[model samples]
Target: MRQPALITFAVLCLPFLLHSVAARAQPEPQSTGSDSDIAITDFSKPSSPGRTFAARTVINAPVQKLCGILLDYPEYPAFMPNTDNASVIQAADDFAIVNMTLKLPLGKIKKYRLRLEPRNTPQTCHLSWKQVPWEDLKADDTIADTSGYWHLVPHPANPARTVVDYFVYADPGYVPFGFRWIVDILSKESLPKTLESLRARAAELP
Candidate 1:
């Protein structure tokens, strides 16, 4: 009788122990953490062939507000860091072709055309863009290739706030030996500033 009682007690406690272990293994919740915190993962290292960087941050604004700011491509230069000019070349309801000029370090400028698409679901809003070649426009210099996406979803613990995920990769092809840092900055260092700019812009909204 005593042995059977001990075995039953051990079985009862096993479930709770397993549950605690699983909960500890889960990722930290953004809502419960600092709102100003930005998490970045760099995958552009030589060992990682992906050549991309990913970042995550929590914004105080809702997804709808952020969506409006992102979809307004023509106004990007006003708020987007390093953007010198942006214009909509062609547009449809769901997609648009936009030409952007970026002011890089040391007076370097890159002009590129991008095709952007907006997507909305019940739970998330997504904006994705990739570089596209344009024949009719003249540019001082064009970047080799660039692509990225922004994912905005309602916070699980707070629907009024948003969780943002940024993914991007850029290839500035054939840089001088002295200017190699430019590639590093474009692919990695500039991520935090880009995300922070969007957060600040959304906060300015009414």
Candidate 2:
């Protein structure tokens, strides 16, 4: 009787152990996609204090060329003015952890550490960041609630141009009801600049 009970217990525990091992063995994602198809779409709600912004552009280059340029972190400041510094702190087969410092016009510089995960293939990628409670700005005033995703879809009409889509959700910290205008203004101004800079960078690629 004890032997049978022990055998059943082992079977039940085997799956959980295997799952843990599989999670540990999984690799990080990579970014490798074409130009042209990268675009931003608007997904923000008016009533909420949160904001979302996206942009896309067509490039006169191949997907591999564009991916090479996109993955070059140290060169971000050269193309994007708002980005002061960006570097890959960790890298693996299917994912990369990147640290970025941005010079914002809102009187504060923002630093974010993003984890890039690949899905579907090297052609498609997703980047996500969780707000660190103590490290976040306006920690005492309000909580930092932000998440974003990047998708790379191939363009059937223009194979040379890849459609890159960006989606961001942000909750403005410590803003009064009437102060929601700040969120609107920031989203409108900053998102366009970011897209334009990205477009310019893609164009500059060899």
Candidate 3:
């Protein structure tokens, strides 16, 4: 009778012990997206003279496929509603100079030439850009100067999912005080739409 009672007590404690162990062993859930695992370093600050905004998303596509779409300048105008036109003037060694016109909400268009650099790694592709100063409007009438980077990082567990990290900086110029509001709205809204468009276009790819 004593042995049976001891055995029953042991069995009851086993589950509780195992559960505690399991709870301790479980890891925390991480951010999932295009650059999910990659560590991001932010150089922008509110105190800095330039204003910066950043956004990210997890794209349900491979990194290679995403990179291809990003570099597809000519087709951008057709699939990306915000883009009025895009043309690549030069390309060499994973870098290209592209001229693009973005449609603003006020029925105006803003054009800029961006120098794109692509970094190809085993599991990721990073793209960064700087505005060509010459392409920027004359300082007297300019509203803002913009620059940013995009990262396509592959998910470790799922090869089909890629995380996209995007950062944009805007330096609102002197003349148009109202332009600041437009820039702020565009910074928040435009990038997510662009990512959605990229996903749609990738799914349609043959």
Scored against the true structure, residue 97 in model 2 reaches a CA lDDT of 74
Q: Quick one: best TM-score, which candidate?
A: 1
Q: What are the clash counts of all predictions, listed in order? A: 0, 21, 5
Comparing 1 and 3 on TM-score, the stronger one: 1
What is candidate 1's local distance difference test score? 0.83
Q: Quote model 1's TM-score.
A: 0.78
CA displacement after TM-score superposition, residue 118 of candidate 1 (Å): 0.8
TM-score of each: 0.78, 0.61, 0.70
Q: Between candidates 2 and 3, name the one with more favorable lDDT.
A: 3
Worst lDDT 10-window in candidate 2 = 27-36
Q: Which is the leading candidate under lDDT?
A: 1
Poorly placed runs, candidate 3 (over 4 Å): 1-44, 139-143, 175-177
RMSD of each: 6.8, 9.5, 11.3
Candidate lDDT (C-alpha), each: 0.83, 0.60, 0.71
| Displacement of the residue 57 alpha carbon in candidate 3, Å | 1.9
Clashes of 2: 21
